[model samples]
Target chain A: GPKVLQIPSHQIIDMGQMVTLNCDPVSNHLYFYWYKQILGQQMEFLVNFYNGKVMEKSKLFKDQFSVERPDGSYFTLKIQPTALEDSAVYFCASRSGTNTGQLYFGEGSKLTVL
Target chain B: QQQVRQSPQSLTVWEGETAILNCSYENSAFDYFPWYQQFPGEGPALLIAIRSVSDKKEDGRFTIFFNKREKKLSLHITDSQPGDSATYFCAASGIASSSFSKLVFGQGTSLSVVP
Candidate 1:
């Protein structure tokens, strides 16, 4: 099975500071996604990126959030001036094609805003 | 509105027992449904899936029973084991004009298979 890798398995930062979570998707995967999960909650869709563009985003994707994959590098979620509500485990996922519902996800990055 | 719903926020089953987790969806356009399994530290992994065209899908000890008319699905784990204890999520997605689409996930059902 292909694996997605997330950097900084755990991060703690002050509220109002910038934070960037990195996701290294499978080598050949094209469609990338970010999901957020608070403690004991459902995994909520944040955004999906493909071909260097944001294809779809949910309301959970706040105005301060942005995503980009420069030069086919790591797909990153950057939050400028984080809020306490932004604290959650961020999981990055990718799939081979659009027709299938299967997704491969990384271990997840735990972001803590204090 | 919440597109997907799951039942039994927490379940406990003895080893070798059969565990059934229930799920239902509100979306009519969704054609594909997948179940994902997650542990404490790991990410959710694809466990199994059933399409609206089929009533059932089985893989090893895991089975998905779907009802298109009811828009409901269930994941049955046969001969449950302690190793099988985890949070299971039911997700649904529609077929887009493109090759892939996003998934709407239900609140997971936490299962504990006590040995």
Candidate 2:
């Protein structure tokens, strides 16, 4: 099983501060995705990125959220001015473009806003 | 409007007993269904998957039975073990059928298997 690494397994930040969660997707994977999961809630799709551009994003993806995979480096989700509601476990996933979008996910980064 | 819904938000089973997790969907266009297993401090791993083309899929002790007509599906873990105690999620996607597809997850079922 391939592994997707997420930096900063747990992060506690003050509300209104900027936070960047990094995901190292599986090697050779093309389609990258981010999902948010509130405690005791379903995992919600946030956005998907490919070819250095965003393919589609859900309504949960706010204007303050952005993603980029710079030159095959780590795929990052940067939230400007984080809000209290933004506190959740963010999971990153990736799949091969040639495959059926069977996603592989990272452990997740838990964000706590105070 | 939760497109994908899971039932029995929590369940407890004894070792060697079978566990049944149910899920249903609203979208008829969806043709792909997958199950994910998650443990504490770990990511959700792909457990098993079934497509609209098939009514059932099996892998080891895990089985997925899908009903296309009713748009319902279920995961049955046979002879479950204590290690099988974890949260299970049922996810659907039109990824294979449509170009614009995203994986949508169910609320999740937390299972506790006692030894």
Candidate 3:
């Protein structure tokens, strides 16, 4: 099975501070995505990136959130001046261009805001 | 509005019995449906998926029964085992264009397979 790796399995940060989560997607994957899940809730779509541009984003993707995969390196999600509600497990997923619609997700990076 | 919905937030079934998980969607544009299984502390993994053109899909002991007209589906796990105890998420996506399709997930149904 393909694997997506997320860094900083757990992190605790101040509410007003900045945080960045990194994701290393599968080698041949072309599309990358970010999803948010609070405790005992459904996984909410944040944003999806492809070919160096944001393909689609949900309302949950606030203005303070941004994503980039500079030079095909680690795909990163940055949140500036985070809010308490921003505390959740962020999962990164990637899939090939094929129409199978199978997205391989990472173990998830759990963020805690105090 | 939750586009995808699942019933019975929690369920318990004895080993070797058939566990049925129900799911429904509000969007008619959604053409692809996939079910994901998740264990604690791990990401959800794709269990099985079915396209709109198909009425049913089976993989080993897992089967998905889809009703296009009703916009609903269900996952049946036969011969359930204790290891099958996990959260199951029903997800849907619409292929509107050549670009990638994003998946919307349900709240999930937690199943406990009693041995």
Candidate 4:
């Protein structure tokens, strides 16, 4: 089975600081995605990337957020000027191709902004 | 309206009993429906899935019944155990114009299987 690995399982930062979450997707996966889930809310899509470009992004994706696949080694999500509401569990997932196929998800990076 | 909807915020069942989770969607273009399971402090994992073209799919103790016309689906877990207790999410996705990945997920239902 394929695996997606997320770095810094837990993070705590100041409200105005910047934090970057990293994800290592499966070796052969072509598509990568980011999702966010508040403490007691549903997980919402943030953005999807493929072929070194952003494919699709949801309304929840704010201007403070940016995503990129750097050098085929790490898919990173960087948030500038984090807000209090930004505290949540960020998940990274990868798929071989389309939605019909299975997706591999990382354990998730829990971010808590104070 | 939510693109994907799930019923019963939470459920409790006996260890040996069967548990049924319900889900519905408002998007007609959503042809791929998949269910995911999550434990505390972990990411969601694929549990079972069914396509709009098929009405039913089963794997091990998990089964998915899909109704394309009604845009509804259900996951039935037979012989439930304490280990089956977790938060379950129903997600849907459609073909993107380009190379895109668009996955719409439901609120989620927390199931607690008692021993």
Each prediction's TM-score against the native?
Answer: 0.98, 0.97, 0.98, 0.96
Query: Per-residue lDDT for B40-71 in model 2, tens only?
Result: 87889999999899999999999999999999
Q: Is candidate 2 or candidate 3 better by TM-score?
A: 3
Task: Classify candidate 3 by CAPRI docking class.
Answer: medium
Q: Output DockQ, candidate 2.
A: 0.72
Error of 4 at B107 (Å): 0.6
Clashes of each: 4, 0, 0, 0
Residue pairs in collision within model 4: none
Better of 2 and 3 by DockQ: 3
- How many backbone overlaps does candidate 4 show? 0
Can you write out model 1's per-residue Cα lDDT over A30-53, one digit (the tens) per residue? 899999999957999999988889
i-RMS for every candidate (Å) is 1.5, 1.6, 1.3, 2.1
lDDT of 1 by residue, B4-105 (tens): 999989999999999999999998888889999999989999999888889999999999999999999999999999999999999999854345478989
- List residue ranges in candidate 3 displaced over 4 A: B96-98
Docking class of 2: medium
Query: lDDT for model 1, on a 0 to 1 scale?
Result: 0.93
Estimate candidate 4's alpha-carbon lDDT, on a 0 to 1 scale. Answer: 0.90
Candidate 4 ranges beyond 4 A from true positions: B96-99
